[model samples]
Target chain A: MAAVEIHQFAECITCHAWSPDQSMIAFCPNNTEVHIYKLLADKWEKVHVLYKHDQIISGIDWSVNSNKIVTVSHDRNSYVWSQEASEWVPTLVILRLNRAALCVQWSPKENKFAVGSGAKTVCICYYEQENNWWVSKLIRKKHNSSVTSVAWHPNNVLLATTSTDGKCRVFCTFIKGVDKRDLGEGSSNDLKFGEQIAQLDLSVTWAFGVRWSPSGNTLAYTGHNSMVYFIDDVESSPSAQTLALRDLPLRDILFLSERVVIGVGFDCNPMVFTADETGLWSFVRYLDERKVAPTSSKGSQFSEALGKLYGQSKQSTSNDTVEPSKFRGGAHANCITCIVLLRRSAATTVKRFSTSGLDGKIVIWELDNSIDIQQPGYR
Target chain B: MAEEGFLEVENLEAIITRIEQKSRKIESLLKQSKPVEALKTALEGSPLKTRDERCKSANWIVVHRAMMAIKDVDAMFSSLDPEYYDILMKYLYRGLATGDRPTCDQCLRIHEKLTERAGLGCILRSLADTVNTV
Candidate 1:
């Protein structure tokens, strides 16, 4: 079977997220409407129309239970929508600090969520005891530029965030001091704010996206000059060794599993890499070049112009991080901006993936062993 | 009701006449090399109500012209400028190689005529090779 499937066409799909249970696929098109397609029913449906944002929706993520979804927008507000009374309703409104909210994520085990805004701060909003729902408690503000992406560890204890400042930081949540009160009016402080566990300085220009591995041990992030850095022991080391892919400027990174790292380049191709036991990474699968129709005359003309501008020098520069072998083909009609992997069931052996690009189309690909399964556990 | 009906007809006629007069003025301006002012005036006259409407209209016009112009070979040749002829030829060759599509045949014939007239042999062999691999 083909590794990539053209799922649907003609909608400006900006971001997509698979439900935790992998029963439904949620995508935001042009940031105008949030579309939810149920996999079981094989039907297309609009779960919510978020007309609140004057700008496009930048990021979206499903809650741990898959009953709710958190969305952030260029409008600088992060919204939480819940499925209640057989209808989707807006539950929480996280007011950001006067900047566009670029990314958002929900904690793995708790009701809390994190929002990364265009400002230099990453806000951690958890359920307030008085309001009975999630609210913001602006945590670390050390980032110099806007925080572009944020990811929560699978254990729900560590939170990783990336920013335009080219730095990624992991923050652990713990009770600094808690306040206790008996039936009396007097109260005593018992819990205090927790300190940051570690800070990984990437020192790159712009860190676009970050993702924590399934095991919560490794964190992958995209930086300038088409480089992707995989920090295996993020908690132990304050610096991550960068693994750069030559000639492919990656815009996003998604960890399909523990060893398999999928980096979506600005050229709109998904390059798969597998890390061996010695920390050496191997170029595994190039999913983009397969099953693409021949380029049209107009496409050729565009390619010729582009080739002239960039030149036909395929040689890898020594300063380049990843070797030229890591570069993949089968480019999209436009830049591939976002990608999400959808696992059907824990028992199921195969996992399917989806990618959305600037061309306003979503392409879904099914990964199976029949088509060159390079990774060990994949087969 | 009769008075209102008369007023509506008069308003429609007046608007049509005003549009015709403006179009003539634009034609004269274009001929006189005042294309920027003429384009500005034409755009202002047909100002789109919303951003979506404007985008839809622009896409419709481009697609419509491309589809309609491709229907006749003579018309396509007449419309092609010297600078765009090579680009059009490459498109034609690409289209023909894409066999099983009738549009490809149409484009091939156009390229054949242009190449014959300009005495430029098929320069798209390398491009064809690259596309066939993908």
Candidate 2:
């Protein structure tokens, strides 16, 4: 049996992040405010409400090392919230973009963060200790459309981003003052800041979620076309493989390990993809194993009369079609938008991961260790 | 601002002219009984960038003709490059949208073969893409 924990936090959550110790979560409830809830005793209690942005909060990430929360908003601003005493203080990062900020992520080192924007640019921001402020350098002109998501390689210097223009690109985000020159090897060490390193145009439709494996040798991303593309040997000769899913398109993806990936989206269930011994990725199975109830052919006369009455009231509709069900027969009743790693069994293996979606419920899924290690390609 | 506007219009005209030339070339290739080359030409610069009905219809006519002229379905599909799969699917859908009986029949035949060869990603990419339309 799959071990899972479900918590309903809001009516609809746009984005969410877990605290370092997994005691608290900060999530945007499809609004301009950020609500931080603490797991008190056995119940979740509201602890803080972060209100600074003028528009809807699009993305949020909590730093694992620094315990700071970084948020980006559609208002074209980003804020880094650090706890001082008991209150959280917000410091604004100067992201000079004329378009809305779409997504943000803290790099592995927690030294700098990258924010994707609608202006076809990504702003890599880092703190200037001398000035005590965050300054950003723009990665410009590479994307033909809005940058949808950003993921950092384990080295924290190479950044991968997906765009609406049907491309996923990896860029060198190593700033002179913020990063060590010799910290990264191969192409990451040699490329200048904001230089495009590799571009993957395997998807012919809008690409949404992107993630790098823990080893940073492989990258995976999802397209709106209900396909997932996995690229191996990204630094050298990049080879891409595409897996087409039969369900609705995935909006976000997470790497559980180098060989296992969990993708969630409009399908309302997390689907797993695994690489074989030959490193060819294929769809495995859904984490949610609940059998969807088949639609009944026989309709009750009362409901049929009601359907006709509703159609007559609306006047423009046919009486034959009934409204679609709100229940998708999965753990999430709506489209899942975000998945964050919660705990790890080892440096490379994920133990527990949490996913939150439009249903406003956060589901914590724990992977059975025995089954994971027995997989064909899993180490 | 005025210069930028004029440049945009001039660029659109150039694209339309280029598409027309490619369409005529595809017709000539079909006349020469080179269905494979004709199909290649039809898929070269697709999907047409312009939303102009005339440019789209002319390209579709050429693509439909090349697809119908092919005698060996399996041989043609076996030789077709994987890179052209998504574009070919798009043209098939555009052909289906015409609602003409022959065009729909030909497009359905090719669509079935292409989906079998390329798997489901080809169809998904064609339907999901809102940016690049034929």
Candidate 2 total steric clashes: 0
What lDDT tens digits, residue by residue, belong to model 2 across residues A1-379? 3437889999999999999888999999999999999989899999999999999999999998899999999999999999999899999997999999999999999999999999999999999999999998899978999999999999889999999999999998878877888864455667888888899988878899999999998999999898899999887899999877655789999987788888989877787788888999988777774332431222434346545654565566544233322222567888999999886436643378889999999999877544853444200
Chain A TM-score, structure 2: 0.88
The per-prediction CA RMSD against the true structure, in angstroms, equals 19.6, 9.4
Candidate 2, superposed: residue stretches over 4 Å from native: A294-328, A345-350, A372-379, B1-92, B100-123, B130-134
The candidate that achieves the highest lDDT relative to the unseen native structure: 2
Give me the candidate number with maximum TM-score: 2
Kindly report the fnat of each predicted structure, to 2 decimals.
Answer: 0.00, 0.39
Q: How displaced is residue B91 in candidate 1, in Å?
A: 38
Per-prediction DockQ comes to 0.01, 0.23
| C-alpha lDDT (0 to 100) for residue A104 of candidate 1 | 79
Which candidate leads in DockQ? Answer: 2
Give every prediction's interface RMSD: 16.7, 6.8
Instruction: List model 1 lDDT by residue over A1-379, tens digit each.
Output: 3245566544577888877786667777786567777754566555545555667788888875656788888887777877778667776576647887877777775466788888777777766667666667676457788888888877555678887777777775532221122213221112233356667765435777789889887888887545677887766553365654433466787887787777775656677777887766665756654322222233444445544433334334444323222322343666788888775655655667778887776777666643445633210
lDDT of 1 by residue, B29-102 (tens): 65675543443343333312222333324422332224223445554446444444433444455456646466
